[model samples]
Target: MSDSQRFPVAAHALAYMAHKGAFSPAQAAPSALLAASVPTNPVVVRRVTALLAKAGLIATRPGATGGSWLLRQPEDIRLDEVLKAVNGCAHIGSPPAGAKGCPISEHIPRQVGKALTAADEAATEALSKITIADLLDENPVSLAAYTPHASCPVAA
Candidate 1:
């Protein structure tokens, strides 16, 4: 998947897990199932899930019955946390090193870097106000309990 898709995909995965009450290994959501909801390849979902697992946002097990489960509640998961968990670069490229003996090159990189930092801060602040639960607010699924036999809602 493209770098830009990491955050959105992560958010969707978490929301899906929450919506389906996948809160434990018994109720875990498989990567293939998650991919079906995103309409993307399972590999892409696995890649994003790996990052989420690393960030402690979710846990995973490998096997026929294995899948992923949330490490925290949906209401407790902020979008900024998801963004950081996936570590998406926000499609913002780094400034190249300033050319030697070129004043403009040196000045421009610093200015651009500052602007990018500010933009990132602004984005994090905005995302902080939103949570995975917020994403599910429209449908209002009951996330209070986990169901071991929760029927698969998306075909994989």
Candidate 2:
């Protein structure tokens, strides 16, 4: 409904890239491959990746043998930065356009708006402390052969 998951998916793609990019930048995965990992469409991956590329979070190449590479180390890339790349954490809802007469409508924008803004800011602050490295480090299995875009799950 809110489509609030866009940022997380973007972050996921980044973390996934981080897993693979540590090996080499040329090993950057394609959007179709990334799509498979995100379990979403390649177009969605491209759209988000474009934003990330513009934000300098990742680098992309076109044509045959081209793909995305992480622009920085996972430890240096914060979650909030990824979210900001996709404009992911922005508040989506707002008071109705015509609240000229109603008291509840008038106050809702001021009060509720403030609350939503504060919540988003708090979330960003919390995310700022976390990095793609944190996500990978938190997962023991990632140290194995579980690179992103790899079709297989955990190795036995």
Question: How many clashes does each candidate structure show, in the order listed?
Answer: 0, 0
lDDT tens per residue, model 2, 1-156: 135767867887988888876335569788888889878888888888898999998888876677788878888888889888887766757756546898787677788778879888997897787788878785644234445446536535
Off by over 4 Å in 1: 96-99, 139-156
Superposition TM-score, candidate 1 onto the true structure: 0.82
Off by over 4 Å in 2: 1-3, 22-25, 90-92, 97-99, 139-156
* Top candidate when judged by TM-score against the true structure: 1
Supply candidate 2's per-residue lDDT for 97.
Answer: 51
- TM-score against native, each model: 0.82, 0.79
Query: What lDDT score is found at residue 138 in candidate 1?
Result: 50
The residue-level lDDT of candidate 2 at 90 comes to: 65
Whole-model Cα lDDT of every candidate shown, in order: 0.86, 0.78
**Candidate 1, poorest ten consecutive residues by summed lDDT:** 140-149
Among all candidates shown, the one with the greatest lDDT: 1
Model 1: how far is 10 from its true place, Å?
A: 0.7
Q: Taking the tens digit of each residue's C-alpha lDDT, what string does model 1 give over 53-97?
A: 999999999878888999999989988899999986455777888
